[model samples]
Target: MVDPSQAGMVAVGAGLAVGLAGIGAGLGEQAIGAAAVGAMAEDEKFFGKGLLMTVIPESIVIFGLVVSLILLFVF
Candidate 1:
């Protein structure tokens, strides 16, 4: 049986894992998205590369979610 106190701490840790990861991803996406927009403005051909770069930061959020789920379920 899980102790109530320990369960609460685990919940907090899981929340923090996902929250901090999301924040980091958002920051990264902000910078990448700006650069992508600028590059796209300069040349239409840059759209593909810019889009790819902008999307890469989204993986960070996915990773964070996986970690959070592991923490929540695996202790």
Candidate 2:
């Protein structure tokens, strides 16, 4: 059986992990997205690469979600 205090701590840790990751990803994407848009505006050919670059930061959120799941269920 999990101790109540320990469980609470673990939950908080998991929440922080996901929340911080999301915030970081959002900040990264904000800059990348703006740059991508600017590049796309300058050259239509930049659309594909710019889109890929802008989407890359979203992987951080997925990683964070995995970590949170592990903490919640594996600990």
Q: Could you tell me which residue pairs clash in candidate 2?
A: none
Positional deviation of 67 in candidate 1, in angstroms?
0.6
**TM-score for candidate 2:** 0.94
Most TM-score-accurate candidate:
2
The Cα local distance difference test for each model comes to: 0.89, 0.95
Tens digits of lDDT, candidate 1, 4-63 = 779988898889988998999899999999999999899999999999998898898899
Q: What are the TM-scores, per candidate, against the unseen true structure? A: 0.92, 0.94
Runs in model 2 lying further than 4 Å from the true structure: none
Residues forming the 10-long window of minimal summed lDDT in candidate 2: 1-10
Task: Tell me the TM-score of model 1.
Answer: 0.92
